[model samples]
Target: MAKITLKDLSHSYLKTQSSDADWAVRDVNIDWEDGGAYALLGPSGCGKTTLLNIISGLINPTKGDILFDDKMVSNLNPVERNIAQIFQFPVIYDTMTVYDNLAFPLKNRKIEEDKIKAKVHEIAEMLELSSTLNNRASGLTADGKQKISLGRGLVRSDVNAIMFDEPLTVIDPHLKWILRSKLKELHQKINRTMIYVTHDQTEALTFADQVVVMHEGQIVQTGTPVDLFEKPKHTFVGYFIGSPGMNLLPCEFKGGDVMLNGKKIETHTKVKSNNFSKTEIGVRPEFINFSSEGIPVKVLSVSNTGRHKIVDTQSQSGKIKMIAKTSEDIPSGSAFLSFKKEYTYAYGDDWIIE
Candidate 1:
């Protein structure tokens, strides 16, 4: 295992990049500790894959260096970097049996036959594919083939790091959860440095110790799942990480107070300066509650989702969403809203006011 470091990383596909739009990845610097499980997360076209490819030596950055431990590997190819990559689709030989497929890498390195057998079986049992060891790779289901891809990466002990690029994309909805759980278990058992790239929040939150959230070719935040949800450093992080997401209301900072629709609002963070071009207050839907006396709002809709209700309300300033208990009475037409001050935050120019 190796500690991966990306120093001032930036990648542009164009020959002559003129603007930020020309860059696929921008000014990324991260230190992935040895044996750490991390997820590169974001929406599509947010540079998640580009950054992953760079780390695995599949692509060299236009302007930066990649290091494994202390050695600079910016110019090394994927093979020289000793990286194992699992793709969205399975990349196993169809003619080979499951055992042979897992043992292919070991065989390529001319490992002893007995050791290869032991290692292949070990990975197969962990992935619950022991029963299908003799089956042809062509006969397995999509999930099964994907498991083989994972096993191939695991069987190799010399890999510097194992990187997954949306490895569960083709998996069925129900099976996705199972595969994700299995991946987490494998990471714990092997204790290898693993980097998973995905656009799904659930995958990132559940499997990774740290989630690197990227937006528009830039990393917005790197934190634990709870940290990302509770204390988002950017408005985009607040808007992207949650189910109903956080409610952003336009506000003005005046005399050490936040004014929203002519009403004084409370927030945990104080504005440092009012020099920003845009200013807003951010509070998660989970932090807002209906109150008898607060900001007046018109209840627009209520979506019942079994245990809880997602209430949509329109205030004078903007739309606000709140999560209410299923048993609680939701007032129709007009009601008042209150934000939990401890969970409320002030923002300027899309970044959190610190």
Candidate 2:
């Protein structure tokens, strides 16, 4: 396995453009530790796939360099980089048998037939395909085909890194969970550097030890799943990570008081009188308490999702929503909200902190 580094990386489609809009991937510098599992997460067209392709060497960047173990490899081809990539859908030979499909990579490299057979059998067993080793791929189910594709990538231990680009899209919702957990288990057993790309937050959080959040061609944040849920560093990050996301209220900052629509709200952070004229106060749904005191809200809708009830409400300031467990009862009419001081974050414009 190798440590991956991206140095001042920015890629644009045009020949020579300097603006941010022209670039597919904006300036980014990050180091992915050796043998670590990482997931690139973001909405569609946010450059997550582009970044993955760049790292895999399927596409070249317009500028900057990529390094594997401190050696520059931005120009290397996919095969020369020693990277194994699994696509969104299964990429196996339908005409070939499951065993042959898994054996293709090893045979292509002129490895000994006995060794290839042993390795293929081992990977097939790991994928639970040992019983169907001789089964033709054309007759297998989608999930079975995908398993073959996964086995193909994992059959070789000489690969520098294994990359996956939304490899669970075609999978059934229930099977997706099982496959994700299995992938995590496999990662632990093999200890290979793996980078996965996905737009789904649940998939990203469950599979990767670290997640890289991208927005509009730039990486907004990189952190553990818990770090992102509890403390988001950007307004977009706050608006994107959670189920209902976070509540953002524009406020006036002066001294220790946070003025919202001329009313001062209590805060955990110390603020100077003239520090920042205006900023945004962000709090998660879990941090906002629906109490008898504080700002009042009108309940627009309430949805019971088994374990919790997601309450959609509207306040004088703007739209506000909160989640309450099914066991907890919400007070009827003009429900009040109490913000958790310690859990709140202060932001200047869209960026958090100061």
Could you say which candidate leads in lDDT?
1
Looking at model 2, the pairs that clash are none
Error of 2 at 81 (Å): 1.0
Instruction: Assess the local accuracy of residue 223 in candidate 2 as a C-alpha lDDT between 0 and 100.
Output: 95
Q: Which residue runs of candidate 1 sit more than 4 Å off their true CA positions?
A: none
lDDT of 2 by residue, 1-354 (tens): 789999989887789886788888999889999889999999999998889889989889887889999999987998788888889999889789999999998898899999999999899889999999998987887788888888989998888888988999999998998899989999999999999999999899999999999998999899999988888888888989998899988887766667777777776665554444458888888788887778878888888989789888888778877888888887766788888887788777677773
Q: Estimate each model's TM-score.
A: 0.96, 0.92
Best by TM-score: 1
C-alpha RMSD of each candidate structure in angstroms = 1.5, 2.2
